[model samples]
Target: MATKGPEVVTDSKEIAEIYKEFSKFPSLSKASIGPEVISQYGGKYCNIYTEWSQRDLERAEWVKFCRQYIMFYDEDSIVYTGPSGNCTELQGELLTEESPSGIFKAVLRKHTNKKGEEKQFLEIWNKNSKEKSINLSGLDMHGKVYEDDQFGCLVWSHSETHILYIAEKKRPKTETFFQTKPQIDMTEEDEDSIKPEKQKPVKGDVFVYWEDWGEELVKKSTPVLCVLDIESNSISILEGIPDHISPGQAFWAPNDTGIIFVGWDHEPQRLGLQHCTNRKSGLYYVDLTGGNCEQLSSQAKAVWSPRLSPDKCRIVYFEGDVGGPHHRCSKLCMYDWYTKVTSTVVDIVNQPGEDGFTGIYSSALPQNCWAMDSQRVLIGTPQRSRKDLLVINITTRNVTSLTSGSDAGSWTLLSIHQDLMVVTWSSPNCPPSLKVGFLPAAGKEQRVTWVALNETKILPGINWKILTFTPPLEQKNPKFPAMNFEGILVTPSEREEGAPTPIIVWPHGGPHSVFTAEWMLYPVTLCRLGFAVLLINYRGSIGFGQNSVFSLPGNVGSQDVKDVQFAAEFVMKEEFINTSKVFIIGNSHGGFLASHLIGQYPEFYKACAMRNPVINIASELGATDIPDWCTVEAGFEYTTGQLPTPPLLEAMLSKSPISFASQVKSPVLLMLGEKDKRVPPAQGLEFYRALKARGVPVRLLWYPDNNHSLSKVDAEADGFMNITLWFIKYL
Candidate 1:
């Protein structure tokens, strides 16, 4: 690591100004600081965490805008899009039901071929018989489809065929919007009526997470709830209130009489409460019978999986602050209509404490962590150290220990189904496995089976084992503090008996996020291709507590790059890794850190890949719509410190990776999204031009329609495929 720079000011304001100037320069270059300067200045940790964590929005309630996985089932099979955009996979296959509950089943899958044309498919599955592939590619589906009460009837937002809010009903056997737009016939009123205004076609998934009542609205292109009418053999749109809201989690009152959904309010035309700034929303009652809506509540925060009881009288959800650390305690709250009480189900589990942020310094996450029955609710609270999972009962206010004495860094709840729970577990020394346990009628939960990922044929020839490492220590509070740096190593499934394998060091995005042993698909795919992958849990990553998380800001680019280098070195010294071909790649903030490595320690890596890197930090600060505390928390303002235009310009210029473009000799592949509002297009273009000017081997790939991160099926898949190919050819 580079030695500390010159002694600087200790006064808060003057030090802030110095930092402003300091950040402008390339990240603390060893060559840039002179001894004379070093003698004049010293450095200290800025206590940004306490202030930043205080700004942590409640972990619950529905925030106006957050993205989540939206999936639909066909037959008995469940399908979902890959988080990395490889392609939608058939998660679980469902057998054909002899006496089907519904007439026909439709599967929604996104398809992207070699040429990269994006399209959505609605595969119609036959319940009575088996068919090779239910191809609905030719069908023109403009909006969303919902199941109505009618047996064969379905509702849709088919903008192409039907006018806005015009619900089209069709027979179960009939293809609704698949063929043509819904055309309204001529009438006396039609003669004088004006055509509706033209707007862009609705694209992508139709869900936005909102509060339980479907009242909070975050505007997503995907629709959250699907309204079905099974008896009519036809369907129509369940159109969310305030038109244009993207629904996230939904809860329907028992009897399925009244539906409550969480979404953003994009339009203010509807008669319900309207939310702002894409925050979590609350309580909207849609009378399925009357086709009307009622505003139930108004709250904001990200609410996870709001569930209704069998009787549908009570709603339960996990709520947290948007700005809070992801590993902090999130509350399980229950809402009752009869009592008009919104009370905490369990005494705010995972409070602000050491074990709460589990993982090496708290990069572990506690989300989608709840289950419920008629009598009580169960919440999975990550215990201090993250080695065990606690099952807490909301009704009795009692806590039961589930898995104990496990390695703190190795165990996590994977999925909860009915009475069965699936977990992905590991330790520094044990490979991860899928462990299944059943809820017991008496005493503790029952341990049933432990299935290693190798037992499945999902991906052939891939063998994964657990890795353990101790986080490097700090002078103060050295005992595995939150956000410490430790690295995990992954080896290829098909490897020579004793030959060293290629290594690709990867830093997860979200300087706040960590690498979990959660059966990652991309890394496994890389392993399948005969490469060793190193996932480093760097400082500033979440799941660790406030102090470790605080270390990331102002210095994330510098410190995280060191962690990457350290991981690479660790691999080189280990028996399995090929020291000659070490490569590094990352997305988002990870992308920025990648570039930092090439400029800062160009010799450590053979080649590097960066996706949506933030090269021009100052430019991003000016362009972002971030809240105030976030800006201060990021050390942007403190670093820049009210400098005049020229000094500020110099400061920004010094930090821009473009400033060191000429020094970077390693080849680089740049991937950028055209519509990325978070890290604008120029961040990529500036670096590309600079590298090209220096005659460095660099290539730029642009996705015209994606924003921030590549989410579309084609773009996401192509990104991984191309990046892998790049690694194969260059690393």
Candidate 2:
């Protein structure tokens, strides 16, 4: 006879306390340190930079009080606080030397009222000038000027008269028509009141493929490039842009004669912007005076990170087949304006390190990639599950690794000014911190200096160690070569020697995504709860070379499953791990793996917890925003409009977790986000129904307002508490 799991328990006070403790664990959200905006004043190379810190968790929400710190740094490392005291949010900042009094800064500010309503305004400040501050609040352009994650820039023209930026604007309202019939024997007043008013139907896009359409901005508003005249405080929308194109990453062309930007066609059937590498986008240039738009990369399927050479003779950009897999290889192309020719400077293909490439430059490369000489660019690429900085010589097509070794964590190249390179460095055991490094001149080796350490609340009784293991050769799938995979083993620091501890196996989503040695809240919390947490980066995960990442496309369930089982088995060999008390947790694709593990190896795990897992590929194909995900992962070529045929659906079903549902014997907890477009709520409900129909122990916890990330503070807190309880009850 099957045994039922313990009844679901809810302790609101305990959950609140856990959330309070988790809030103190700070994570760096944003950092601004780059060469283009670094101010050189009074014989000191200084810059105005800002960092957003996760300060406090909202009591009733899943977000945090992201406190902003705007500071000024000089060559001597003296930090001066700026005017961030009254602002609830720092929207954007632009620095320019065109002002008569040294350098001036234009910053956008957002203030939240007691009622939680937000109002934004623009402020111009010059410390040395008599007009220390000027507020441009009344000159509203109907949308926000700030776009997060390196998508848009608030920039000043070379002449400094006008500021250019991207802002959302309301779509034009459509006219409505209606017909009315006269009322019988109605008086004049009655007839006047009975007149029918035109009814306008609500208009909105279905967003079939565009899942990440309106994040952090107003819905139904179109993003448009606009120019603001500082002197007159008047805004003018840039003209000549086609209605079917939405512009981003806009900046002034050389000499401020025009604007150069990357634009995506407004295809209703196009995939979401989060999967931008799969979208057909192009680089375009529009003259400021004539407002004539010209397509720059017409021959390329997708173009991004377009930058003009300092000499103004050439333009360099990345071009790739957007229809390829998520981590598609891209070619660095240089266009010579003088010769009217274009050539590939370097082809970034996937291969083993030291001789071959890992992946394309990060999508956020434009923010801090250019070198002083303009002939070299600094980029970050995934190498064996860690992000490494690479210097690519555009002139010679040479790629040099600046940071690589056992201590390899993740490095973000922020800015290169003169010989100084600014970066954010972090490892599995270390939190992200800002660092200053030397930009090697010619053949000099690179070195770094720590600038600021991130504030972290260390849990008194928790500890973690990084580990790697090679599965037995016999366990490897014939189709995919065996490679050593990596994982982090987190455990309570004060456990008795040789004492058995419950183990939680965690697999990351995006079979293409790798688990970096970054600070994650959930894993740390699990470790604090006296459980050994194993975060595995199996085959097909990024950070490895192209071969390893592409190896699992046609073998998702089989190869990936074998790798996870091998990892779990290898870890279980340790006498300190209680094999009988083992549990598993996963999100998205990771959840897919967890479901498969519990089903295929039914007796191996005591319980399973999945968050927005992909249950059935066949059903997911019609509902998921990334339908191409199903086809591509199933070993089929990715296509935009192709619907799954009967045979293809069968193949997908055969590869899905639902195929092995009947074999699952462990209790399951399904945490689903109702608004998740990536893996719809139905995916979780489907798995729940399957387990329930079989009388397997099951429970469903749904967050109605959260999205796929489940990152909202409330949902995240709830999920952590529920999962902890579920594991404790069943493991």
Candidate 3:
């Protein structure tokens, strides 16, 4: 019943056209997408002020207001272009400064917020007329002042000058700053100069952030608490943690005399600390107001993002099981200051696993990237077997499913403004867009309103339908025979609405990771572009029990790759899927599988795209930056324990895609972030060069400013844009 397959073409002419069309789609090199996220109140929701008599309250209004980047603009204004680009004018009263002669000013920039360019900036305003044209924020990476309203006119100036002018408070122009290299106090390098006496507080290290809170500001590089004084526009440091800590989640205590920060103190290699992990970490409070610090929690492993209630009555944080083989899955815990009692707030232990759909902890998240609010907690439950948005009841401990894992959608809580919550959602098929949802009262369904839809793509207009197919039963590993193996499939809603769609067999990146049916932009983008995406939860992925996840070590090559192959065969049998036009794409571990699939089954796929792929398994083992001590903790030797002595090396090499490069017949597109230290750019370059040398079709794209993950807005856009081109050409 399946649609007719494409005729096999061995002739060079067909392959030539495929390669040429792939090259025609202009590859994106620069950031074309705007800002994807914005935050207020540390990017979480919870109203603070019960009431405010003045326009700005220092603790409730001014302090919180000054902590974030605020946009300024006038309601009545025509768009104008300056020397640099289009601009908007804003005028507001100088809330912080004492200057009586308020100045008015205007600014210019794109209305759409892009990721890296989100820095606030300002220009100069004339003092005489209380008005000035906003100037372009040039090469200076420092924050600036843009607009001011005072007396009768508007004024504006850059924050770099450390000067303030008066202007109207309504839609006033202001400035934003940029990051510049800090001047280190290196004068003491002179051997003769008496070393400045190292000052030590009664207990902790004194940490300070110049503008933003971060650990990078410290000279000694110890884990210290970074604090900001909005009244004085100054920073302070409080140090006392056991080891060097990156500035994780931190906040000034209600007393304001002290602050609290969380960091890890454990064996780095055992827990993959190279990628930022803390084995033994807890909550500690330092009295900047001058008092002995106190330990708030025990030595339970923790993930950063900590939150304090408005009244400072309770502290909420994520707590991981201590000293376990599977410590990654943590639960949400809360501690009450008044009762002096600690308890598990959410029942993560009962959460269902991805494998047998049985309740068990795999992954519970409140990563530094997510936010929380007063009425409910917005938690990222990646282990719900899908990327889920879970709304937790603050008082009753009840959980509600907000958004189902759409495999095509991503939901993020940005900021909270009174009764409204601002969230962002995006997918491969959808341009990132903003949404506002009304905070549901206790025990009520949250009513959400979609706003500012990203107009960059048209995929959302098409409907998508779900498709399911059971993969053939896998022969259990000779070693781990108890493990279960299966795969999942998804199709666009458009298929039943009209015509059959092409197929894209997707393999998740982690040899130990599984792909969920949750909404994601990546696969959604392909489906929107007219392809049926089949994402498999191969043998090694989590959500399944321990046996399933641990099975990956010895099976990354044979069993793992077969899971993908079996998935392809299942979808190919579906009457609605076009079997002939399949393509494969993946990154990191998935990249390894994609490369291997193309080599092993070249005739099955039309093309492939790899992002920061791992080509040589053996090379990765020796060259990976992970600490040498990790070999024992990762259990690599144990997994390959039964291999015969002579063929051990060959077994590892056989799993590597690079070894079989000569067999690859499909066109390949590879991209890597220059700063990605995890799976370095060398991995992709090595494979690209190898395939090109053998006269196989290939293209390589490298991002200079990004890391293992493209966190920057522009870099992410460029990465996704290139992905679009690859599929448009080959599939």
Best candidate per TM-score, number?
2
Candidate 1 positional error at 196, Å: 8.0
lDDT of 3 at 131: 31
Write one digit per residue (lDDT tens) for candidate 2, span 1-731: 33222221245465456556655654444444423335555433334344444534555532223333343545424344333443253333332222322256555556666988666655566655433333433445455554454355677676667777777653333322343345367566775675232223224432223223532321423678888787877778898997777788787777888998888775655455563465678888899899899888864487777766655677788787766466545677887766867888877555655564565635656454667677777777666656788877877787777776424567777656554566667665455665555565555434433444334334566566657767677756565554667777777666555557788999889877777766677886566556788898897777665566667787888888888888888889963688888999999999999999999999999999999999898899988767778888988887657867888998899999999999999999999988887888999999999999999999999898888888877787778888888887874
Instruction: State the TM-score for model 3.
Output: 0.60
Could you give candidate 3's per-residue lDDT for residues 478-553 as a string of tens digits?
Answer: 6666555444454555444334567767777645455554335556544544566777667666655555554556
Where is model 1 poorest over a 10-residue stretch in terms of lDDT?
46-55
lDDT of 2: 0.69
lDDT of 3: 0.49
Clash pairs, candidate 2, are: 61-714, 62-712, 62-713, 62-714, 63-713, 384-543, 385-543
TM values, all candidates:
0.59, 0.83, 0.60
Local distance difference test, each candidate: 0.49, 0.69, 0.49
RMSD of 1: 18.3
Query: How many clashes in each candidate?
Result: 108, 7, 88
Return the candidate ranking by lDDT, descending. 2, 3, 1
Error of 3 at 582 (Å): 2.0
